[model samples]
Target: STNLSLSIDDKFIQSIREELTDLQRRLLTFSIYDKQTSIKDLSKESALFLWFQLFKDIIFQLPKSEESKYEMIEQCRQYYHGNQEELTNIEKFAQTYTEQDSIHWYTKQCFISRLCNKALRTQDIELLYIFRYYIQDLHKRLSLEHQSFRNTELNPPILTLYRGLKLTHDDITHFQSNIDSLVLMNGFFFTTRNYDLELESALKLSKHSVNILPTLLIIQVNVQLDHVIFAKISSQINNSNEDEILFDIDCAFKIHEVYFNNKKNVWIITMSLTNENRLIAGKYIETNKREIEQG
Candidate 1:
């Protein structure tokens, strides 16, 4: 007779981390593989989406506290324990950070960006909750910039943006297949009007591995669309150019085209902003509001 035990790998741990976004998520997501006729499936989907909105709203509404800020810095210290420069930056951040410096710190791409970007990309709710104060500050700054766009006459009716990056062949293939589908980016979308392709964006293929693709995203936005919020962020941060435009989190885009530019030997994917978020979650938000008011 032999005894067998189950083992979880890094990949399985990652999937579990993504699924467990909040304390209440277990009630909604547990037994996704089990067939249960007790509840309507669509309702569960709606509830999960609604929970995300509610979770973010609650985090944003919570009062800023010195304790939360200190905890964030401490977590940064622990997370970057092996990196001396990041630990030094964490110490400085703990001692001298002001509310207004949030946007600058984020764009500086230091420890804050490192944590925030990873949390967003991986849907790491625990890390996101810890950094809620800074996240709210960044969102507020972008919101103000977005609002100011309405009054600026210099703002164009149509804007073109570019982002240079490298992706796996599978990533490019997914884009190619989902040409007309909606793309909901997990975090802030960074693009520039005059993007010079970065050297790092070009992946060097070797005999051992050649699954990389250089991707250049061409995003066009109709400035007339008021549903999604985006703003020019170059002026907000130091040591930056004027070409940076940032789309806020949770904004949805429609993929219009995807093709390989044979001349440049890179993939060119085009997308446009859309109001799909409102289309999907507007009603749930209203119901959520009503339930909150009733409770």
Candidate 2:
């Protein structure tokens, strides 16, 4: 519950109350006050309401109505989902606003960045995918904007402030760092059931840093092992019959247990590196015992 403890400034809250619709405000209130209201329960409209309210203090203009605001939100959602028609509509919408003076343009970028963070925090993989599309879109926009500014030789303080308020290279890097941290944390919670998703997350994390290879390799080995064996080993570890497992780049093997034919079995899983980058591993040791004593 750090989410429960999250507090907004009174001024910001007041501004949100003024700008958000009655239902939107209620959703925000319930999300903050009611501990049982999960983020997933909120509809897309509610999510967009929160997204807009997050930047109420900085945004200079407001959408004319809840319906119009929701339209904007839907456009973003559709664009992220790869709707070609919506993408064209969104591009047209972006062109309607002047890059330096347009609150609409700036808000769109903030919306994407904040939504990505929200998706990551809530562990919504589907939402994360949608946010990623917009993240890439925002990245391209920033790059082009930077190049345009250099070409036009317009480096005014106001334009610089506008760029600072919108997405930047540092902002994208920070967003990606949050993603890497989430992937690494998710890898630790991997089980046989979610092996594919966990492996995908681990692979994405590996692209960010080589140091994660050992951790990824460990999770991969755990994922590839038989579920029955893993279950029994996990149970033994939980029961303290086996010591807690430790993971490292150089640590070669781990010993654990499994059950077969109503008998106790022991297993040793070993790991090694082919080079600085590649990992190889194997399992050995299988001994059944009528009565295996606990540690």
Candidate 3:
């Protein structure tokens, strides 16, 4: 230890203590995010408890105005200043994006999808607030699309969708424990009506890593279901041949069954869109949204 002067003893000690505390916080945060860290998954109730609290702070924090929206886009523009292609896309988005094109921009391989998905999954309040302008528009667009989608006479009464993703043991266990419970999707859920492509993707991902389990989600949606919004958006975007369907952010679904398919060496979970759980969320969230819109 360095020798300290008597006059500086108390102040210097406090400063060093504060520095140590900050350093410790940084280390702990890093460890929490480390891939090797084994963190227990929060139960659905606990996670939703956190979500409602966080949503209260986040959903209302965004300043609604033309300038704030521009500033948000400029922040994204500055973020990708180093990348020429993204820079061009960002500029084009700023000049050309209409509310109807929200899904088109989102489905594109760009920063909007990456940033919004990450912020939504992590529930990063600051980023959520920052991107609120685009997010709101995207959800609005999806709702409009949903109306047209369900009314299409050719569409089936019950639509089945498939998603392929990699999950950890904790992720699988979380679903297992939450059977017959409501799950609020935190991000924009992407799936396709094509089974072969999804299965192939699941197989490829399953082989990529042993630490994560390959999972296939078989989601069934009833066109008559209310209080949830999703749409067949492949028509809205160019060059998308997967017959892609996208569910709006924060849509709620019921998990009916989860099982490991031993033959395929993958976990298959089945879910159905339900309005029963959304009735609870709707009561509170609708209140807040109405207040925000009225203001």
Candidate 4:
């Protein structure tokens, strides 16, 4: 492993050095050094002391005591071993996981630590996917639990950086206000099945005053329209074979899935509308799988 001598908690570092089973230690080390996944690459990249030194900067920030240190190491071990089990039923997992603050903290550290390691060693999109999966999962879970727009504090800082770097069209609207709907079509609903042109159309349309925006991600079919000042969001259907999930707009249109089962329907009815501001928000609800178009 690259020995960057990144500062970390001494006691916590010591526990990682001492308490972890040989296999667990090796797995942790490999996660940091190999820049990718697989038992073969892990074995090849595994380094004991060097890996510990590289994370020194971060580990040192935690409380330093024999007991506290061991506790944190055990937490790390639990995280590495627990994630597969945790993600099985995303809704169930998120509901249970977020209730416990420690799990949330552990989850946050686990990804950042892995990302930091990957940044120093590899150049592959797989790591990026790994990062994205975690983020999307977390976002969905958080939204489900809260059932409202995410507060500024809870938004993942890393995702903000990811958007800034990628410069995707959605990135532009992410920070903007007064925009209500965004549609991104990817398959079966795109014009020529090209998402790029469709995205361009939406971005261009952003110049107009659309109270509620739509982002479509279907293939070859991309479109945008201004919606009524007051609207509610729900999903007549809940599940999808793929990661994508659909939501309903007042039983009229299917939108994208933004939350998990733990949350109720994200129905944002027109609570109030004004010349300067239009607010559409609602309680979270569960959904099923079906398609309906309102006339």
Candidate 5:
């Protein structure tokens, strides 16, 4: 019997050791192990191997210095000035892995999130749009699988990208139509400062009857608005001056009371808003149920 073999030169091994980060090296090692241990697993492992290399090439090529950081920011700002062909090629490359089923859904979401963060940090609108397309596809797939709630978790970063790009009204409405109401509301929580839109999203969720989170989000947003802004919105609801009054003041107060009664833990609300705004501006309205009972 004869066996075929190949050898990797020491120079090549040394080059890889110098070039690859620890994470990349570990992924490569796993790929090799998967290939040798189970032939059937080779496809997925190989895909991951390629994906990691591409990830490094695209994401990790930048140096880890402040100067490099500024350069990356500037590069992202001027991405439009780059060769169109090159940008299109990069977008196409990302699309390939994004459409593949070899990676786990959570892993894919995490990878896309990283790409989104980088895109935002660098103001790379082209890459951001590419990421948004992938996320929209993911949301569709997840909706079919009845994992739409989990899909909601994947939306905030994409929404941030939209805000960064200053997407048109049609673009925003198109996206809102494709996603679940909870996701739309959650996205609004992070991406929009408009009190009317926030209230509208919350009201839409309230119709579903199980959407306590949106109600809590509404309360959070209401508490955060500047006193003057809040007063104007309150006045609109009170005087029926708004074109569409989703809920009157008493109705809104009732919903807030229900939320406080059901969710006694203040930390839940605080934790939910942790990543939402740097300054969590919501004042928690204290429930007077205990006082009423004592009386």
Candidate 6:
């Protein structure tokens, strides 16, 4: 009886060892294939905890690129501190972008464009407009830093609007005004029974020269290309106002740089009239390459 009991205990130990070895083999195989056990097998809270643990482990295993490290540090900081650092390395990262950096920007633009399109479809025009301006701001920062970005095979459709906007500041302003006035200008502003006609008249009056030093003078009569439209115009072409002139000069230099690259100048103008704000942009193809070069 004593011998039989000892034998039974030995067999039980062997069985436990065999079960552990099989389990270890299966776990190793799953890890190799990047498979996780079914979530259905665990409670929701347990699954969430497991996911967080796995995320931490993968983050630790990432290669030691500066960006990767910085991102990891930021994630950990934000996760624990409930906010990001005020002096975040965004500026540093933007400065370091080269032609290779264009891919990442392009990827970012693509993702944002999808979101913007969804907003547009839902008639969330304000949100869509914000997304458009955000992209412009990003591109301007990248361009001003003189970064060369990689060419993307798939161009975003908004690039057409963007290219057109770069023509002259007024051109962008005109485009933005058209969008805004389309939404706001109705007979409600005036007792005129011809509200539709008045809106059409207003749009006609709002048209400005798309040329260099485009005329922006104001007038009284409600007519197309009239002074009444320019009366409320915000930007003036005086080379005297030092601060304003410097801002315009900066824009001029940016156009010069883009022209040299065989690219058209696309300018964006943000303007506010009364309670409404609008964005104007355009694309202007340069014909005087020799003249520009001489200048």
Best by TM-score: 3
- Across 157-254, the per-residue lDDT of candidate 1 in tens digits comes to 78877866556676777677666665666666677777553322342221123755666778878876876778887887675555678877666667
- Compose the digit string of candidate 6's lDDT tens values, residues 6-72: 9999999977755443222111000001013232344343333333223323333434354643443
Which candidate should be chosen as best, given lDDT against the real structure?
3
Ranked candidates, highest lDDT first: 3, 1, 2, 5, 6, 4
- TM-scores for candidates 1 onward, in order: 0.73, 0.21, 0.76, 0.18, 0.22, 0.16
TM-score of predicted structure 2 = 0.21
* Clash count list over all predictions: 0, 0, 0, 49, 0, 19
Once model 6 is optimally superposed onto the true structure by TM-score, how far is the C-alpha of residue 49 displaced, in angstroms?
52
The deviation in Å at residue 95 for candidate 6 is 19
| Model 4 misplacement above 4 A | 1-108, 111-113, 116-123, 130-132, 149-295
Estimate the lDDT of model 1: 0.65
The CA lDDT of each predicted structure is: 0.65, 0.29, 0.70, 0.26, 0.29, 0.27
- Candidate 6: residue 114 lDDT (0-100): 33
Q: How much lDDT does candidate 5 score?
A: 0.29
Give candidates' CA RMSD values in order: 11.9, 24.9, 15.2, 22.7, 24.6, 30.1
Candidates ranked by TM-score? 3, 1, 5, 2, 4, 6
lDDT per residue for candidate 4 within 1-295, as digits (tens), equals 2334434465568656443321121121111122122322333322321232223223334343445433423433454566763334333333453322322432232333344234323423344233332323333443353233223223331111000011223333432321332221110010122334434443433333343232322311111122211111112112312121222111111222321112321112111111110111110001111212221
lDDT of candidate 3 vs native? 0.70
Model 3 TM-score is: 0.76
lDDT of 4 at 136: 32
- What TM-score does candidate 1 reach? 0.73
Which portions of model 6 show Cα errors greater than 4 Å?
Answer: 1-105, 108-110, 117-124, 145-295
Determine the backbone clash count of candidate 5. Answer: 0
Give per-residue lDDT, candidate 2, residue 90. Answer: 56
Task: Give the residue spans of candidate 3 off by over 4 A.
Answer: 1-64, 153-155, 282-295
Off by over 4 Å in 1: 1-55, 153-155, 198-209, 284-295
